[model samples]
Target: MSLRKQLNDILPTLLPNNPAEAIKGTELIRLARINLTGNYSDASLRYHFSIMSCDPTSAIAKVEKGQGYYRRSEPLPALSGAQELLAWTQGRLDDISGDDSSVDSAMLRIRKFRAVVTRYYEVNGRFPFAFRDPFTNTSPLGNLWKYPELVLVDWETGGSPDEEMSLDGGMLSLKQRLGIAPFRLHSARLRLSPSLMTYREDFFQTLSVSMWAQGGELIYAGPIADEALADGLRKLSAAYGVGVTSFGMTPEVLDDLPRPANILNAHPKETEAIMAKLDIHKIAAAQSRPHLDWVALNSLRSESEEADKLVAWLNHCIDERRAEPFKDE
Candidate 1:
């Protein structure tokens, strides 16, 4: 049997699933040798490990921004990811035909991506408020057009990067005195993949959901590798004023990320390591408006409870003369 075959059979048992607990190549080779045949040298074993880790079906995986190997969990089927997203958006959950394992894996990736985006923006000084209810299983079909998955608030704050900042009092006062809104609201639509077949829906959904906000953005977990897709997104963004960006999360890297809870609660060091894995690319910049569409925003109050909470939260912060990360409670 080939060494790759032997490693394929042997590595799953030796490699840990968690990336943080990945076994270094040196140690993995040592353990793998006990079960590997043909007396492979360390260099040969290392080379095999490197090559095999790149194979999606292989039991082993290399961390994207770190050393060592971990067990690569089985990914959501490549072709089905978009289909699943479609079924989800249409609220036809019954149409998504997958076994429990695959469905759970798909949902986990969606959640981890959300957690990653939330943390990414927060650390970059944008406060993200997720409208979870609109995307939940209980939501009605076509809600994607009616509600954004996230609303990112960019506030003018004065403070060090290491600490949560209070709103810049002078800026706040000036905006209030001038009767201008004190923040930029960029509504965002998050998706696991960016595909030619689905980019239009993604872009239009982002635009529809953010009609009331100052700007809109379509964010994808995976990189935008296809030039035609990039061009298409750029054209739509140019015409419609929506932003398009990717977090550079390939399916493999996404599967290797920590679970949603751990990601959301990541410490500064852990968050830093995770952030290092991102390759943020801006396909197009969102055009901001000088003012929000108040008449359009008023229409949402009849549809989404989240819309009310969003308004109330902003009012609370403005009234208190401070800016802070949101707490659900």
Candidate 2:
């Protein structure tokens, strides 16, 4: 008799019930393991099988199988694509200072990693178990893949009205196409004028600064009061009862500081007076201090009244930890 026929007949005796279905399932798994192209060793196959079986007890077994696969595939050459990707990611993590350029590059690298993995999946029809941290041998996909790209665009000078509108629409469409939920970080710029100072209070009160600090980009307009900005943020955190180590402006704080207060400057004398009151050196120092949490915002500003209302509602939702419509006046 053929091997399949013999297995179908004999598996019934070995397994208790529904031997026919079990046999078919096993055959399908076997086919999947052998037919798929990208790097499925025997150990990987066994791991895949355990996962497919859906037995709770098989978790440990799968880990053991994974470990075996790693052992067998050890000593990946220094120049391999996987090794290079890991090295780049590690380097970024190690040397990432509070510089905007550095942060931007790191984010780009993350996106590149995602693109690589996604391409592999598309071509191979499965995720490679071997694609993991070289040191921990653990997959970062679970922790990082789901996190949306936190892009910070300056609202002013980012684009023309038509271009900005197109980009806003594009972002929404991209999220839908990728099956990712809408961005958690609202893309609203926080203006620092006296009139908007009240909004800052509402911001601190309405959103979980801790949660936002954990992820997302914070873009801001140029000419910010770096030191005052940091102090204000720190005070807000304290007022809200959130324990934060530090809060400060980005490296661009110096470049973006309100043009130095001078008679020749174009800014109005009153505006320059306000700018002169800001201690640039002190702000820079506060921002440069170690152990301080850096807060950034995207530079993109929403001009629409509707967008402003959405941001307000989003703030409310963030505070409540639910996305329900805003009911409170």
Give the C-alpha miss distance for residue 79 in model 2, angstroms.
53
lDDT of 2 at 212: 32
lDDT comparing candidate 1 with the true structure: 0.79
lDDT of 2 by residue, 189-208 (tens): 12111111232432332232
Off by over 4 Å in 1: 1-91, 159-164
Backbone collisions counted per model: 0, 17
Evaluate model 2: give its TM-score: 0.18
Every model: Cα RMSD to truth:
9.9, 24.3
TM-score of each: 0.72, 0.18
lDDT of model 2 at position 151: 15
Clashes of 1: 0
